[model samples]
Target: MRMVWKTMRLRHVGMAFFWACSMLTFRSSILLTGEANTPELESIVVIVSFVANMTTLLALAAWAENDPERIDRLPLWPMAAVVVVGLVLVHFAGRVGGGALLPFLLGGAVLTGVGYGAFWGSWADCYGRMHPARTSFYVPVAFLLTAALFLAVSLLAENLSVPAIVLMVPLPVISLVCLVHCRAEVPDGRAVPEGGSKRSLLAVGSLIGLIVASLVLSCLFGFMWELTVFTVGSVNEAHLAPLVANLMVAVALVGLVLYARTRVNLDIAYRIVVPVIVVLFAVLPFFWETNPVALNIIMSASYGVFDVVIWSLVAATSYDFAVSGFVVGGIVRSLSVLLRLIGIGIGFLVTLVPGKPSALIVGVSLGALYVLVMLGLFNWLRHKRKAGAEKLEEGAQTDAFAQLDTSAPDEISETPGEEDAAPAAGAKSTDNTMPAASAKPTASAERADLDDEQALYTTIAEDYGLTRREAEVLPFLARGRSAKVIAEALFVSESTIRTHTRRILEKTDLHSKQQLIDLIENYE
Candidate 1:
């Protein structure tokens, strides 16, 4: 936990500022709610802003795909400049007069959205440098802090009104500065590993099963958004929906902290998302007339909880594959936003349904959710079976390795020089597969090589001052095994393996696991 803070505190500030910039500038439901004065115009601006944001994200992905190295070359300050200009335009849109208003708002929306997209790409780059284990904690804490900061800024904006745009103007620059500091702390050019495109595809393909599920969830959220905006009478009440939702996310994050600390076996948040959504939507129709605000609470909370889950998955996936974060984040986030738009369209379409519209929405949402749940269960079962089979195979291999006689003829294992020497006259070899005369020397040579490698690992570990656990992890890393394989071998969590791997890198002053392997391979 202390390690997490030490490495990720700057990231927390950067991420919070990025999120707060979004809420302050374009997301109409939060700090900027009603500030635009022209509600109709504000809606147009918000929609266009999101569309532009999606397009910009897709474009960045394309750009990153064209040359992953380009990410490291691109300057951060320019993006910051773009964001500042766009923010100024957005902030002043409401204050300007008639003929200039539309153009100003439209331009500002484009720039803000574009800059927001750029920032996401940059964050993906940053997250790629971090380990998935640390990111699980880092991403959530950043968000929780973002929510708290938004709450404070929103309150200040409520009191100061139009002048609040002044408060938001500097956040982007500050965020950029923090990101620069973060980048300085971590090594660069490691984000785009070899064969990044293939790895990115594999990562995305692995998560494809969750796409429909995520889309359904977002659609349900849009349905709730539509209902909240159109039906709720008070502007404040309508906006409270997002506020409550953010708070719900904060609560879920606290639970996530507990799950991490306690090492809970249960999948605390994601698995329960469907059930909670079902129950909330089920009760929505009943409360439609009496207290539609309840609808706001339920859907917002669901979206918030799901948002954290999605972000964590994104971070973990990027970390695991060591692919271009820009590509992965851009693809997933772009699709997510696109789905939310489609869901909003569905929200609009449901109004045309005959009789009880709320009931129709609830019914459709629940049906889709039910299908998603079933698919998830099937996938889980298949994965469990496959894991069991893999465990069996691993056990067999471990037994095979254990059966090998490590001792060489003539006590060859005693010292490097002795190991290198030929077996004493007439010594029998352990292997039954070959003739005794030739096998004795060959088996001795094989054992010598193994012992030599083990000795190299020991020297490297001691020189790097690796901890006992890290030293245990080092040999597997040198042999080119992944964090998962090492974790299985050590009977520890994958996160623990990653943590030890990170420590090894830090102590050795190396940039990556590949570097650590190279050090071992090239040792004299």
Candidate 2:
């Protein structure tokens, strides 16, 4: 548990700061939230920003694929500087010309989106190179820190808007500095995976599934965003919503870490949350007017949990598939933002319904929830079928072994000399000159040696505190199996095997696979 915290570094803080700033762009903030007479003006500016963000992601992905060398050389500092300038312009334009300065506001929004896309895409690349164990520990802490930063900025918005804006202006630059350090920390030896066709089909499928799940959750949250108010009790308490929602996210992530420890089976988490989330949406319409604050908290907290899960899965998939992190991040996150925009539109339409608008919102929310639930069920069924097939295969092997043992005695007498020579094969020497008791010890000794070997591996795994998946990968690694071979044997992706191998090495404080095998060999 303590080792998990030791993995935290400046990279986590960088992630938090950039995310806080990006989120601020979408919300009601003094600096970026411009004054517009009509909702159309605000929506148009938001839509443009989102579209620009998606465009930047796809562009970065294409660039990474065509010329991988240029990713490291991208001009991030200039982009960050431009983002700050755009925000400042938006602020000034809103104050001076009010609704008349639509062009400047739209321009600023586009620049902000472009900058955000670059930063987030690059950050995903960094995470893709890292081990999942370290990532699992860092993500929750980053979310917690982002929440704190957001809370502080929100409080400052009411009384000291200038200082708040000033504080936020340098966040993008500081975040980039931290990111540079993170890149430096990665070893040159970790090779960038080559060619998209070589990537695992399972890994690709998992990536698509994760993206769809995220989009569904994001869309639902956006729908809820239209109907709910941010206030807790009074209007002033609205500012505290981000803080509260983030705290809940932190709690859920921490609990998930504790629940799975090393394995972090996200499928189980998905199954557990689906029904609870469905029930929450079902009851939301009833409380839409009675207690808006509670609805806000529930929706925000649920969405925040999914947010971390999706981010972590995206990072893991890039590493697993050996694809460019920028490519994976850009494709998945851009689509997520686009879907959320669509959801907002759907919610807006529901709001405009003549009478019983609450009933319409309820129907739409339920429909979305149904899609999400069906996806979970499909994944669960696939997993169960795979497991059953593996079990049947094991049973067949065991039966074959049993048949061989029963027939061994009859074949033993025909070649007594050969049988006696191969003592470790558990064969009985049916020689008339030898006692039956002498043959029994040879078989028992072979069993003892096998037991001893297994015990040694288990002891070493315990001593190093390896996660369940890491422990499973260790014996295969010690036996000199390639990652691809192990992945086939275990019914997982090669990238997944590599991740588990890396985690095992990290936990054992060893530098290479040979060192791990040597340790096991030398163990008493």
lDDT of 1 by residue, 1-524 (tens): 43444444565547778777776555443323334554345555666777888998898888887467777777888777777787777667666746776787788888888888888877876765565545566666777776776666676767656456667777788889888877665543244346767888987776676655677777776666665665653334465556757866876776666466521222345666756676668666766878777776777666666656666677567766666778888888788778777766676576656676766766876777687778778888989999999999988865654444333233444446542233444335533322233443554477789899887876665444343457678889988898899988877789888888887898778999889888888986
On a 0 to 1 TM-score scale, where does candidate 2 land against the true structure? 0.77
The positional error of residue 429 in candidate 1, measured at the CA in angstroms, is: 13
Q: Which residue window of length 10 is worst by lDDT in model 2?
A: 229-238
Residues 1-524, model 2: lDDT tens digits = 34555556666558888777776666444463435423444455556777888899888877776444467777668768767876776566566674557777788788888888888888877776665565665666677777777777777876665555676787788888888888775533122435553453345466665666677767876666654422232222433564577776786677767665663655456546755775677777776667665665776677667767766776667665656567777778888888878877886777666666567767876786788778778877998999999999989966776665556555655664745554544435544324333444545477799898777776665456454456567789989999999999876789888987887888778899999889888976
- TM-score for each model: 0.73, 0.77
Q: What C-alpha lDDT values do all the predictions have?
A: 0.67, 0.67
- Alpha carbon lDDT at 246, candidate 1: 83
